[model samples]
Target: MKGFVTAGTLALAFVPGLASAAEPVCLTQAEATSLVAYALPQAINGTAKRCSAVLPAGAFLRQHGSELATRYAGQKDKYWPQAKPAFIKTLGADGGDAANLTRSLPDDSLRQLADVFVEGLVSQRIALKSCDKLDLAIDLLSPLPPENTAGLIALTMEVASTAEPQVGKIALCKG
Candidate 1:
């Protein structure tokens, strides 16, 4: 699903110079890139799944820092756990196992999906923890819908290319 915000929604999402009434929860492009970079360690070590599951979403502030900061600031802990299963399924020795599950995907695309799936860690926010509900948000990001399995396939590709190195770098810097 390629993002579907209408002009109105985009406008509403961005009020004045801020990102709507929500403020930016803003992270500069560099910051956003760093956050994603830090996550790679988890993905590589097999702890990322567990670490990320318990890690606060606010921890990845670059992507949605402001919202999470405000949403979770001062809270004892803002951990998400429902995503445990998906995270486990994502790991493979060389990091190609998950991609192999999908047919005909490019290596680059596989890498991207790996990162997005990691980013998709948002499901940790909910208690249900079911893959079904987790997918709803992922589906929304798809912009292509089920009809475009190819598009979903493509999403992993796009997200991988843009999200991995950049955000991860920023995250390490912050840490």
Candidate 2:
């Protein structure tokens, strides 16, 4: 993974100013899991609300968690390249399948989707803040370097899948 960045890196990309304010801290599997557990679902819920037509967030995560995890784990270096465009497209900035779908949406659906996009950005900002907190907190718990980026990404995907049942209980989309 020549250019593979960890989850922490992903967080830093969203909040670069924070990067200079703090040093990277080592994260244990448990701590990493805990952070992802708290953040990923929130992201999914917001993303689902915005991109539900493209993907039923809860059900997709639930049903394909392991498979997707495996695929992403193998292609860890590719995550951002794929994710950035999708993110932009979901926000209706980039043209592609998602933009086309956005065009086809009913007026009410489009309005709601717009809300979802804004909410998703807010959620991402929150998630990044949480990651920053995790970085600071990790120093208190461990003096070692952080775990592998690929492993962290894999773990996040796996944990996110488990949220299916909980997401179902309060999912934005029934499907």
Candidate 3:
């Protein structure tokens, strides 16, 4: 369960603009869930690489990370439509120039940029000590369908947003 928090942190790292926005960008539930589904596989792969040395030989990430990533990756195209608009909105909240530039790019180019950005950020932010716990967490949650995993994360973020409305953070909008 603690590792779930770590997972959330990894997902949040993808939104560097969230912490610097003048006003929070609100994502609808669908948008938030789609974004999580889109990012989760990359986060898993990045963490697996970043923490490989510290994780035990039998760790879930070491043994199954690629498989898990592939499973989630399968859903990427399905989630991308909703994720893109939400992502662009977040960029708009960050600044006009960034939003314009992001919008200017084709979807294929934007997706590539996003994938690299998320993997790099997730890898850099993960702590070495947390690798074991994250491995267990990934293993625990791996059985669920990707949509369920994504929904859980989106729900968690929604609860957190309601509990603490940070000015520059991303929030899941209330229906």
Candidate 4:
């Protein structure tokens, strides 16, 4: 996970002067932060567990938004039985609950995970047409490997933290 690239690193991954190619999927810092805040929870909550593949974040999202969403939509109705069961199962698999997994990590680790999660979501939003459809976005973003559940939860906690005010405020479980 430490070796995984961050947003700024993704920019560097492109050739110099090809700014459009490297331009982050989230257009602004606020948008990036807001997207991270919104998507992190749904990801860890297990709604995405059915996701079996690892999506390429960053430019992939920028280039293939609609195609990715359509491919991941699967058979579930746009309106579903509910997403909570998946979230609960994901949380349970990680550590029995969100608090148990998140409360124990070092603060810096959580923040680092938050940074990575932010990059992933911004890329996801860019690919999915700027987060217009919550269900679709959730499906597209949920493709994270199951091994990252703890990291995802830690990132969610860091985003939700009140002490580090720069991350901005987030509302979880809106439904």
Best by lDDT: 3
User: How many clashing pairs per prediction, in order?
Assistant: 23, 0, 0, 3
Full candidate order by lDDT, most accurate first: 3, 2, 4, 1
Local lDDT at 37 for model 3: 84
Q: Which parts of model 2 are misplaced by more than 4 Å?
A: 1-81, 88-98, 101-133, 137-147, 164-175
lDDT of 3 at 33: 81
What is the C-alpha lDDT profile of model 4 across 46-132, one tens digit per residue?
212212133334433334434443443332232122222222222223355574665465755644444344334434333222222
Q: Rate the local accuracy (lDDT) of all candidates.
A: 0.28, 0.35, 0.74, 0.31
Which pairs of residues collide in model 2? none
Best by TM-score: 3
Which tens-of-lDDT digit does each residue in 1-175 have in candidate 2?
2122233333332222223323322333443333332233233344333333433344443344334334423332333333333333324344678767766777556544433443356345434323333333222222222233323543433333235332111101111
Instruction: Judge candidate 4 against the unseen true structure and give its global Cα lDDT, from 0 to 1.
Output: 0.31
> Pairing residues by index, what is the TM-score of model 1?
0.20
What would the TM-score be for candidate 3 when compared with the true structure? 0.83
Residue 98 displacement (Å), model 3: 1.8
Model 3 lDDT per residue over 1-175, tens place: 4444665554464354443456777889898788778888887888898889998899999999999999889879998988888767766634577767888899999998778866776788677877776787778889998889888777766655554333226687878
TM-score of each: 0.20, 0.24, 0.83, 0.25
TM-score of 2: 0.24
